[model samples]
Target: MGNFTKWLGAGLGFTLGGPIGAIIGYAIGSVIDSGVSVQEYKSEQDDYKRKTKKRPKVKSSTSGDFEISLLVLASIVIKSDGNIDQRELDFVRSHFIELYGKERANRAFKLFNGVIKNEVSTRQVCIQIREHMSHSSRLQLIHFLFGIAKADEVVTASEEEVIRKIAGYLYINDRDYGSIKAMFYNEADAAYKILEIEKDASIDEIKKAYRRMAKKFHPDRLQDIGEEHLNAAKEKFQSIQNAYEKLKEERNF
Candidate 1:
């Protein structure tokens, strides 16, 4: 298991760079096969599956599997505050059904229930997700997780904390997470509001507000505040970019 983890960590670093890395890792692992026929390997795998209490097949990508698992963990954290509400469940269900088939979506819910009952460490689960998924896909998966967390029209500090911690584990930097958070908070709406315009705001209004925020939060300008605040300023600048895009799309401006 230690060796496997080491290899998995290297594989994750490789995978973060590009698709070619993932392909190469798969090829290398396939070539280094431990002298077992495909049929024999399947038989042994099945035996291991039958013997182990954990879901054996989950480690493989059965399409949207990693994403579903993330949502499951996020739901567990969100519901830790109280009972899982119907609104929260419905939000999760809609996202899953869109990503995976209904059957798999239900399985995801059940699997999440089982995992939470066992008190699985979300960090470890996120590591598995990183192992099986590409960097971009993981970002999108985290976005969906945050979306569901905010879907009840509110985000508790606990839920936000869960999302932020998972984002860090997933290699989503503070900058990117801020963009995602802005998207959730309808900062696009704020952008339009800043411009005294709507989704149909003119290109001139868009440019004007962008220029104003850019100057206010630019890293160079924020340097006087210190490095920590400078870094935060960078993240805020990115949120401005996201907000502009959202409003631009909404207005086709």
Candidate 2:
């Protein structure tokens, strides 16, 4: 729990307030219930306050804010379909391990377990996120939620519906939402959708759309979020590339 405390102390900012803070406070209670001393936790909290007191507050979301938000939103999406699939749980755990290492991932999963058992107010949570997080970061969050929904190789309608609502609440526009959603589906027009273009788009139009989306979803947009999220952004970046390449091939451009 030392690492967990350190992470909470250092990697959080705006998330320590609002609805997110309320959720995290509950999770922290669960942590205390699990045997971590309240004194130790308070000490860490005091340390964090001291460290951050002199620093100017920035609107950008911190890595810990993004991480906790992911866990909370994931819990909502997992339960959206009315059953918790072990495969989705495994996907979330494995993805966290890959992003945060084994120890950190284990600690996060402990919090996730607490988060998953709660009833999340999705709109309220998303409104809070929209206020603090960047548009690119929110898009990445949607991408991750889709990955969870599709973990069983089938994205259920309920899951998709819930994700769409999340996207809307996060202020993701229709074209952007369609573009990201296209990454998880194999429909005939998926490539066009992924590029935010149309099937009937001319070669020049397609090229322009590809360039625009390439810039929009570039991995560097997430660099400040941490290497793990940057790597995930690369995956989304590659999907755009693949979609563009497919279009180029089909159009003989």
Q: Which candidate is the best by lDDT?
A: 2
Candidate 2 backbone collisions, by pair: none
Cα lDDT, model 1, residue 250: 68
Query: How much is 134 displaced in model 1, in angstroms?
Result: 1.5
TM-score computed on alpha carbons, candidate 1: 0.52
Q: Write candidate 2's Cα lDDT for 138-218 as tens digits.
A: 999999999999999999999999999999999999999999999999999999999998778999999999899999999
Candidate 1 local lDDT, 123-205, one digit each (tens): 66566666665554565555566666776788788888888888887777775566456556655356555333455657887
Find the candidate with the highest TM-score and give its number. 2
RMSD of each: 13.6, 2.7
- Backbone clash pairs in model 2 (N, Cα, C under 3 Å; residues 3+ apart or in different chains), count: 0
